[model samples]
Target: MPRLFLLAAVLAATTAIAAPDNPPVPLPKPPQADRTPAAGPPVPAEKPKEKQAPAAPEPEKEKETAAPAEPPPPPPPPVETEDRAAFEACTAELKSLGAAFRTLPRIDDGNGCGIDKPVAMTRLSAEVAIEPEVTARCETLLQLAHMTRDLIEPAARLGLPDMGRLKAVHQASGYVCRKRNGAETGKISEHARGNAVDISALEFEKGPVPMKIAASEAPDLAAAFQRTLNAAACLYFTTVLSPGSDDAHRDHMHLDVMKRTGGYRYCR
Candidate 1:
């Protein structure tokens, strides 16, 4: 008990204790360095954005100028039924029939007179050669060839057996840019468009027979042969103006591919 009393008296006399209301004083601030910049005056409140008039619409920017619309594209060219290629389906027929021919450059004489795909035909088959060669569209020459092989030659063999195998065909005109019947102008002739052929005579190994021969003067068999040949031509051609049809075509057979409805044909 005496020791405990002595320890309590020692703790009460220590100087670490202080009165409850008293506190220590703060220390002074240190001196600033010489190189330190003094604080600047308060920035003048930013002047409230200096209210000014709105900028003039940026000068309307030239309205970005409409960029001139490109001129409308040109129109497409007109299409025609005869515009098929030079040797389309007819090429196979030409080869099969043993024809000698070559494609020609386009013939455009303007004013609706032209052949888009022309051909120069020298012969139809071994049995028949086109004297002077025919310059017309492939379709036109093909028609003539088919007629020669299937009709004319066969007719000659049967009608004029004395004449050796029909050797050649003498053409009057193939492609001529003139009016019908050589008139000044009424309507353009099929020859002008490379769509017609004119056969003036038939040459055989024995001799030649002119187309303009009068029926009365011609031998009975020859007259009959001409009539049959002319009739058969209608089956292959759209127009057939055979000998004696008219004075204009008396010296030749004027055959053409004249388009018509329902496969119409005019065979005189």
Candidate 2:
């Protein structure tokens, strides 16, 4: 009986230990719409390329569309003046006069006076007071004065009364025997060739007034005279000096064709 009880106890203990050792496993389930598979790491998808078309050629645009190229800038117009024809004619005549005197050999008056002796030409005539010592082309000198008158007359007609009434012109001194100055002698002055004229101002009804005297006493008349004479000189003379200059010249208006295209003008 003791042996039977021991065997039964041993079997009971083994069964109890085995029962707690492992639980029963459940059966596999069928796939369902809502069920998901076991997941792994995610991977990236590749991008697709687009098809390309051929490039087209471009045509040139017309010049009209390109800012018109600025029209190449029109040339400047020529200068116009009222006395263009007469002025040009006088200039040509004056040129001829110059050619005649350019070749005359310079002759020195042998009196230790360093002055050139001028040759007198019989061609020009004069009406102004002439210094006996100086000689000049008479015809050319007269022509210059006449041309000056023509220029002044037209301007005078414009009702600039102060320029004087285009009165008779009187050339006081032209060709003179003196040197350019009383001191050291040099080339003969324009007076030597009668290429220059000293106008004793203008002849107003008040008599021939000197430039210096008029500037202080009659400013309007003086200004008009100076302006008109200067304008006339531009057409006739290359050089024009007036009493308005310094003490070197305070007596008369001196006019000469020494320059070519430009000369000094005065208004006093």
Candidate 3:
């Protein structure tokens, strides 16, 4: 019995000795939220693009326009019409009187001294010739003719018996373009308007008798005839300027039909 128990103990001890020596190691645990790593440098934000302004529009062209029209002119004066009629009538009368005359055009000096219609008288009547020809207005020529027929011839028969028949009238000046008394400036002379005559002499059938305004030193009959004619001229002429009037009229007799304001006669 003892031996058998001893054998059982020895078998249990051998079985223990036959087992492995090394043991297995255990795995690590997972990371928690509080134990995470820190964040890196932050990335820079991107910059926005700049906006641009719009351009201005071009100006429009101006429109074309038309201009206005001008007005008409005025008519002529009434006095001019009347003067024209009077001049025409005078020309007709001259034709009827058998006076040898020619119609001349208007004479204007552009200084307010002018004749509208003038006549160059060649003869006073059929028998009486105007020596050197007298250029004057129709009215002035008519007056000259009337004086020759009515007064001069009849008076010559009495005062100038030696040369009783009339032949021609010697005119020194007619239709002269000058101011009064040949002055440079003043009222226009009647001669400028063909309204005056400067009688220098009278040609008779026998001979020519030169007119001397201051005839105190001349022959008795000649002086008497000149004086008589000088006095008679005032009856027909509106103005009669003889030698004694002024130095300007020393040689010849100045006769005109210038109108006066009060039917006054200017005989000097």
Candidate 4:
């Protein structure tokens, strides 16, 4: 009877401790995934500032600046009426002399004469009357002629020695009114437009340079003529070649406006 009582107590204890067969409550449904993104503790709005030492001052910012403006370009110079009139008159005169010359606009040498500063006669209309191919060059030659005459005639006014002393001043070899080299080739020479003149020898009252015995031996007369020609050449022509230059130049003095370029002068 005591053993029976012990077994009944044991059975009661086991029944009281045994788990139920029903499933768990399901955790109260969580809060639905659509209603809440996560299951975490709520975050504070503003973080609490911690007490600390004082901070150093920051440097000031520099102000931005604007760039400077560029200067304006200058204006063109006024044309000279006097120069235009003079050129017109000269052109008319040349037309009467059988020259087929024409007047054209002058191109600036790009020296900034108008842009940098103003000046009278800023441009020139060169006289060109050569063949069609070299017409422009021929007009330049005509202008060279005028320039040459301007130089030589002044010397005569200054009481310089007359060329009459030379053997063939006007008659030794007449002006060909032709090109540079021989007369056969159509290729134009510097002389075609009166830019150059040839003098095989000079004539004087005494006789031609060849006929005069002492004159041929003396260098003064020849030297004087050469000096005069060269001086005039410097004023009018960009290039000047004489008998002394080379064998090709042994016959005549060749002069041309081969230089006055880009406002640079080359006279020799």
Best-performing candidate as measured by TM-score: 1
Per-residue C-alpha lDDT of model 1 across residues 127-189, encoded as one tens digit per residue: 689999889988888998999988988899888899988889999899877778889746778
- lDDT of model 4 at position 40: 78
RMSD of 1: 21.4
lDDT of 2 by residue, 101-217 (tens): 221234433322111323333222232222222344433454554554466456554535544444444556765545453334455555544457666644444355444433534
Clash list (residue pairs), candidate 1: none
- For model 4, give the 10-residue run with minimal summed lDDT: 113-122
| Each model's lDDT | 0.82, 0.50, 0.80, 0.43
What CA RMSD would you report for each candidate? Answer: 21.4, 16.0, 18.5, 16.6
- Give me the displacement of residue 130 in model 3, in angstroms: 0.7
lDDT of 1 at 25: 80
Worst ten in a row by lDDT for model 2? 122-131
Off by over 4 Å in 4: 1-90, 93-149, 153-222, 263-268
Query: If the candidates were sorted by their lDDT against the true structure, best first, what order would they fall in?
Result: 1, 3, 2, 4
lDDT by residue for model 4 over 109-203, one digit each (tens)?
22111111111111122321221212223334345446434543343334235433221232122123333455443444444333343334433
